[model samples]
Target: MSRLKNLKKLLTVLRVALSLVAACTFSTVSSAALEESISQPPDDYVLVRRVIDARYFTPESVVSRPDAAGTQGSEETWPDIKLRPSLNLKEALQSNIAREITISEQDALSKVVLREYGFGQKNSLQAYAAIEEKIVELNDLGAPENLKAGAVIKIPALPRMALSEPNLLNKYNKIPKGSMYPSLSKVTSFDAFNPVTQAFTEKPVVSGDGRDGSPLVIEHLWLPKDYKDHLGGIELDQSYEEVQAQVISVNMESESLAEDYQSIPFLSAEERMIIKSKLSGQPKLKPVLIVLDDGWPNDEAFYDSRKFVSEALEMIKKRFNYPVALQHPSSQSRVFTDYPKEAFHARSIHKSLATLVELEPSRVWDDQRVRVVYIPLSTAQVYSKAMLEELVVLRLIDDFMLGARGDPVPDKEVKAKRKIARDIVKRLKQDIGVKDLSTDKAIIESALVFADLYAVASGNPYVVNFSWTTRKREHKFTHFDFNQGILVSAAGNSSLNNCKSCRPNLAYSKECECADNAAAEERWFAVRSVSNQDVVAVMNTARDGSLQCRSSIVGSRSVDPLAISFNGYVSDSICGTSFAAPRVAWLFAAKLAYIPPQEFSIYDAPDKGHKLREIVKKSRQGGASGDQYGLDIKKLFEN
Candidate 1:
């Protein structure tokens, strides 16, 4: 019996050794096959080096999928495997936990392991081998053959230094260089400004205007030409201004008749000529206006709605002799279907641009050098519920910190608190079945819009017209400091009572008169709510300068320094505060144009908005006194 047992043990050992050799051979063959498959990577895919070094995993860190079949003669089956916490490899290794995932048809073992471990794709052989061994050991996968479609596997918990590390394969999935869409993976900087002459050598000279004889070269870092070609093109026509005005009037009046609204009337040739005659001898100064709103219609019609944006901009250029560059969404946008109100969006944009350049051309500065840039608000509100919830919670956290700890919380504490908030939001989202709102495409598009806005603002003196608003009161993340320019935001149309003075404690005390006991009235509006000095809010007013009943009062002098503007028929059928905001934007642009380029340094001052407000106030007829300062276009230019 001893001799038989010894022989059987030797036979069992030999069988096991032979199986191990066969497995090694199979793994070698499978690796070669994987190499062959990845040799010709897809067009959208790119190879990336490993970001972090591989670390050792303890035995307890390895976990296996439960057997699908029950033990022999047993009636019980194992429960489905629960997913490990969404921690990176390093974190998982520290916690001694392994994540279980099922393999899909398109997944390669190497890519799967790389992505799962936060190592990114196209990792080096040495880096891949280290992680591969642990993954295979954890799931008892001897060969790549075990990684079949729908096969269950365990991912060894790995740690990544940064949580914001992006998967390279996912990052560059479809965005190629010079594509219509802008790249969001990297921070884009627009440092180079486009010269008015377009030629690098020929600098346009703006003489006179009480300068020191040196030529005043006005240059702006406008949107890139490639970006323009993709989103909207730059329209620069040198046709006689009067002739262009006549063409604009004829086109606008004819097209408006077909739309749902009454006929759109533009500045008549006679009216335009009279304005030109008033500024006949003034030196032409190039003033740029950036309009932020919904996208305009491309040549192709998504629907039968009126297509007046391109025509309106062209007419504005003709009437004012200014070049208009639009940064709206292209028809090729993936989220094109999301924007159902393009017609209304286009009208609002048109109303703003027209209010600034055509309808109320500054009498002091020649309209010849005006430049209008239209930037789209966004392709669509593709923000996920998770992101919105996170923002809401984060805002509350910030407010609490400000009230308790006071302003400027420490960076370390802020990061720690924010991380906890984000984790809470993530867990809640999973429990509530709220899908993440952001996609690769949406992120790229949104990033492009903001990047363009930053680029434009960084350049020459510019006025950004935000004729839109969001219900979210606090925009801690979205708030931008236009140090070189000013932001004119529409005080939303929600008709909520102003609660600018209401404190946090007041809301709980029930003494606040706001519609919802809000801590701040600006809470209902985004940009308007921001307490930045550069931002000026505007509300709607009748033709005679009486505040419109429907418009929301910002209730703060700092917010609504120049409060009102006429928002009527040619604006929107609804006549929103959207039209009112642009008139103020025009006022700023006109003031910028009035100042000599040598004195452009005034915009760099912190009190530039205040100085401009004072300058505008002095120009007001009767020097309008009260918080509700009505914007008078004629008086604005008289000073």
Candidate 2:
């Protein structure tokens, strides 16, 4: 009885307390709240829960704050500066020119010309006026046109480019992991094809490889004056109407184009007159060069340059080994080069490399940095025999030889050829082991880019370049690759490519055609190859991502690239998939200690590769192609 009474009393008291609590809750919900008040608040108030307080981020060592009233102050430093056109003061000074010069709206062109030519005060004003009148009469005879806006304003510099290219030939900055191109430059004559002639004779000599090229000939051909006589004089196994033999020639000296515009355009007679009055000045300023030409050349017993620059850098670090580099997939490049140079410019390749370093590229627009453009649709030939047989072999096996007939390459038929490429890239790079390389460094790099030019242009500390230029695309070639990552490249050799295709049998080339099959092959010896950014080595970075190796260069279609021309030897070397940009980036790492920042400026290191990749990531242009990996040579040493 006592226990029941105690329980009833306790229940009554509990019920009374619950009623009071409910009344307070309802009142609080209906009333305005305060800092200490626990009731419904205004829209501005966001809920804050603190299970574990944090003042800093661990591992990364970044200072952080808890999500509370006091933590809203942290923000990106100077958000406005991220844009390209916004122009931070110093960046503005780096611009080509400040302004444009213009004449009045009602300016009369001939009247001004007459006045400038001393018409009125020339002792014979009537005669000068008569001359002007006669000139006007001639113009009237030609055609009756609007004479109100008569002044033919002379624009000294073209608006097509950003005025003069003397300073910033800012390339398409496509931030590594960011966006696509957003820059320009000067003194860059790197046009890829001749817009006017479109002939092989105008192309530049390639940087790396044997005189003619690899054993497998591509699309070009070389003919000698004695071809008819030589074949006629001898009894050959195979005969043709013209030259019948393919010979390998070697002559090393001279080569390629400048990406930025280095030439000065004529604004008026003033420029010409000034040159005649002044004495010869200093040396000419060159462009920032990059390249990569691959293959088996340094090993050949017969012909080799005075210095095999490709392997020259290895001498500096004989003990340390480096990472093995490989090609990424083409279908996945972020910045589509349509040419081939797009491959190595993989967003991750640069970003990851930049991450290793620590700095990043400045852009025109800060908000939306880069664009990643992924291309997953597979078509025809993507990989070169060298890349597929070499670095990718470990990734793939004999079961993946996909051609017109999807089957593996027969081991017995092409074992030797396959071994050459695989042997070169797959070895554990503990030290410089390759024979063709001149130096002792173990981390040898290769690419579609011309590393020799990069070394020469950027001034690598421990690098000797092996590259050259040429007049005809079908002539002998020169090339090299090396440890300390000296990259190289071969030009796309061909004739006037007037936008056409080959004959019925696919015997005649797009540029050069012949009546007979044998004649066409002989005529187009160093056959012109097609490229689109870094297609040279569209490596399968991870998930089938890629970058380009082929690019258009600085040269315009009206003129062939002034840079070195190159091509594969036989009909087999069809695509100009030179392992370019990556090779230049590789040399950047291998020769870190010896040289200063050359290709791109070296700033404070901040995950060098990451920054490079960030440039693309921020742009988000390459999309799927951004997945490929590459070295960030720009951040070798944090400036």
Candidate 3:
């Protein structure tokens, strides 16, 4: 009885202690809430995250709290100037005496022209108005009609001014301090170790001895001059400024139309859930893969109807890659076709990107700061072998805007759309090879490019689902620019030229009407023999997820075991080289994450693609061979 009484007393004391502790906890929470309520919130600029390496980001460390709250403060000191945009500042536009000038393909309402005509950054409104008047004068046939080729129009011939201060061109040229990530120049100053050769060099090596590698040979292909002329004719008459203005107009109209579009119009709630599920455990990158597919005609059901293509897009997102979808399935019988209106713009944009990267090799390292767009086979048909080589030497494009596609068709309709696309293409082409890109940095970096050459010909016609056929070889043509970045392409989906189901019997000979009976072996040579150091022609892996002696293309120069999606499922029936190409691109991007931009930039030195190629080659392992010919990527980099 005595012990029980003592236990009860102990319990009473324990209860009182617990209640006191709970009260103190509640009091602390209440005090914090009150302090938070009284304190001013941090400004958005203070909260904005700064990108460290263009690849890595770190949030601002600034903190806001009540004066009485004794929390530790951040050490960073900021400048006193406000970062917000200035509002309602009125400026006047001044124009010099004007002279008559002829408008030609070479003519453009560029910043230089604007400045020469006495317009400055402070005169944007006046500059825009003057350019608009020129466009209106050139387009005699009302809205949507293009400026005729060779039709000379009068323009102001103001005396060229000194590249004046406060000019728009100079302002754009100057990269503001703290605007860009810290320069990679310092990081890349040191040498790299080559594990394969056990030597210290500037960077890794791919093949053919260290920094003394041979020049890469790339096969150039071209469309008949007539075909190119037919497709590219629209550009013959357009100027860069005119087309750019038109593209801007179209985009503005698109934005207006999009205002009424349903949020998540094409994808359903279930589909969104599916996407979420797919993306759940995947690695996210700073850059998004912008899948630029062709859209069908604007029918309510066409975009609204939930379908297989939508799911396929989700699957693509699930492949540890993120996608920014621009268009979906086309109404055409096949997913990819020739001569689509959008194809012209896609091709033009690709050429523009390639040129820009070539001029500023540092652009290759700009992961999302720059973009990688994926276009269909229609775009690939425009490049002939020779034109491709020529593309490397062209002037860099300053800016590009995509031709709008998808629901909510613009009011001006197809004619307006055609005019817009043609003008843009024309502007892009005319602007090429004219600008002086001598000052652009040749910083080497890992770049990604995907060519969806489905049923396309590179001097030889490729049968649908069949990649191999007799191809015209142009071994003599080679380019050094191919080594500037990693160029991933698909080994076409083709088979052997057999008896019953052969394509045209005269594929390699006289005029034959059947599909060619070219085998995988032949296809391998056709695709892989492009002879570019950075080119990696990829073949689809077998259904069992292995790189064996399957019916897929086989060669020393080709890679294997790439997975493709049909309706977004890798196991689905719709499999081809088109799907395989992106996989290799993703692989390259993943490997690039491990390397600093400075490292890739250093390799971009004029020493040839040797440094860049070697870095890629050394990082790769688990191929069919220990030599350059192996296609497997089992253990790309050892931990």
Task: List the candidates ranked by lDDT, beginning with the highest.
Answer: 1, 3, 2
lDDT of residue 114 for candidate 2: 37
lDDT of 1 by residue, 80-182 (tens): 2121112123322322123356688988787686555444334344445556765676667897557788876666433321222223333221111110011
Per-model lDDT: 0.37, 0.23, 0.27
- Per residue, candidate 3 scores C-alpha lDDT tens digits across 480-589 of 23333444444544433232121111123222122221132333223432333344444443322322212134333243322221110122222344344444444344
Model 3, runs deviating above 4 Å: 1-372, 376-484, 497-530, 543-569, 605-608, 619-634, 637-639
**Which lDDT value does model 3 have at 507?**
27
Residue-level error in angstroms, candidate 2, position 436: 15
Q: What is the alpha-carbon lDDT of model 2 when measured against the actual structure?
A: 0.23
Better of 1 and 2 by lDDT: 1
Candidate 3 lDDT score at position 624 = 33
Question: Each model's TM-score, in the order given?
Answer: 0.39, 0.17, 0.29
RMSD of 2: 32.0
